[model samples]
Target: MYDVDTRKRALALVAQGRSLNSVSKEMGISRHAITNWLSRLEPLPRTPPCVRCLESPGIPEDTAAYAYLLGLYLGDGYIISKPKQHYLMITCTASWPGLVDAAEEAMRKVLPWPSVNRLQRAGCVDVKSYTRHWVCLLPQHGPGKKHERPIALEPWQQAIVDAHPWEFIRGLIHSDGCRITNWTTRMVAGERKRYEYPRYLFSNKSDDIRKLFTDALDTVGVEWSTLARGSDPFNISVARKASVALMDAHVGPKY
Candidate 1:
């Protein structure tokens, strides 16, 4: 627990453009507490921290866990900000308990102080946490669908993508992309031959998001093809034997 003076100091530092990570380390306070304190401020200060001040070191620019979570959030998560509170929320199919667990682990690792709750509603599992730093990590948050507006990663997020493309791909495929088997029968030689193969399919309404997904796939040398007609949603797929093998190794069914 911190005193009134300590809380005010923390808020003042944060308002000064200091990162919660750096403030927590220097002032010996948890980022979670710092976030809550800042949220309570009646009038938020507008001064963006000058990096030159060198007080707030900020978060890790690139981490596997962070990269993975970013991809997952981009694919299936959102930010919720209320008058008194804000949070990052991710919902997954209730059937995929393992995926929920994986997302929970990533949140715990990325946030300084992470608290996750598993709520059930309409056969979907909602995993969420309150942390102002989520905005720091995912600046693409705003009104409207990602496709309706613009979607781009910050420089720091790009660094994370550059460092751990496979993990990002894994997260994307696990959350929004999927592996499916296509079967067909054809007459070969004298009799009909039955064949089955696996392919990875990713669907999103946003073109920018589709590009990000395919870019990550390219980073890991996984070949993908776009399958979409005019005025339809964007889709990318990986169907080659070698590519399927690679993706299967990294991404599997969630629970």
Candidate 2:
């Protein structure tokens, strides 16, 4: 009878693209025995159980990725959970391909078991990951739009956001925020001078989501304020010089 070690060696050789005959000859095992071992090899796991749904029900191991994903979801992410369809989608602008890649990567890091793909829209790319567990991971899934409903984080999710504030902020900025430089010219000592104002702006129609962003900014000691162009006070501006510097250091542009 072949021992476990021998069986493992033969299987390893076969896994490395070696033919059954070659493995049998190299390991001094019969072809029938090798075939039997291969057949008995347990099927690889299809999809791992959601860590947040287990009996113990713990937070995701990659809290940083989870936090970032949470921010992206709050900003421009969508979840469709139904009897026939389920997935998590994050919309990224086609102009910034890097954000699309980052969104896909964050989804993978948070839930590596599912399949992630990019769908190109008219002017944007949708990074989608298929899994019903997304609803479990993000309880904010509901029937209405994000701004139309109450979006709040659970205790565990809040803990992750608090722990990785920068990652979370980065995700939000990458999804719905922008670092823009507005400039003006002024006559200084009879010479035309250019003054550049570089700042970060996070815009969302949901009041709760804007509050969450401000709360995270507060946690990170980044001063921010609200801006209203006409009547919609849906803009959070991190235009303070110090705060802008801090944002540049951590969350910079969405490239």
Candidate 3:
């Protein structure tokens, strides 16, 4: 078994944003050793220690275990690409009745055979149905098509996203879209609800889509400041800009 102190140090290094490879090299340990320790530990429940806490009068040994657990969970864990793509595309059919089937068929025809082969190699596959008129595609190691951007959320915004669960992220996107619909109804009575309007609606879950971009940043330790005034807690323009910047970082080109 690994010593508790060693595990604590490893956790601290992770919080500092050191990659597993780098940490293993610097500490003269194997990545497997770190992974083994992390597997044995539980995630931390409370907020993580700030940079100050890590640098300040050192963390307690017991606290270190919790901190390590938190670090491992909060830190970027390894994403094992099953030779099969494990990602899913969930489209909301409540608005676009027949769009999902159309999208799937179109994708199959338009996407090159090699592209499909790559997806299969990555273990990615497309799933669909015609009767339900709603379809979800599960691509194994699906193309990195979504992750084409560097995240640019402020530290606090990132924290809120990190602190909350994944379900919360899904809820936020759905709720935010709902709010946009509410605003649209008030501003333009004749216009159909945007959510129901298929053309303008897009899945915010795409890796390139930054609906939860702010949350991803928080997981990596960015800080966001609260606004002094405004009905919306976040400044829309700033958030959008940050998201766009993140996309450019990951995607290699802007959309």
- Largest TM-score belongs to which candidate? 2
Number of clashes in every candidate structure? 1, 0, 27
Expressed as tens digits, the lDDT of each residue in 149-222 for candidate 3 is 34233443334335543322223232222212112233367765443211111123333233453444355433
Report the C-alpha lDDT of model 2 over 46-106, residue by residue, as the tens digit: 3467887799899888999999999999989998776534679999999998899889989
lDDT of each: 0.76, 0.86, 0.33
Q: Give the per-residue Cα lDDT of candidate 2 at 180.
A: 99
Question: How well does each candidate superpose onto the true structure, as a TM-score?
Answer: 0.76, 0.80, 0.21
Best by lDDT: 2
Ranked candidates (lDDT, high to low): 2, 1, 3
Looking at candidate 2, the ten consecutive residues that score lowest on lDDT are: 13-22
lDDT of 3: 0.33
Q: Tell me the deviation in Å of residue 198 in model 3.
A: 15
- Give the lDDT of residue 47 in candidate 3: 26
lDDT of 2: 0.86
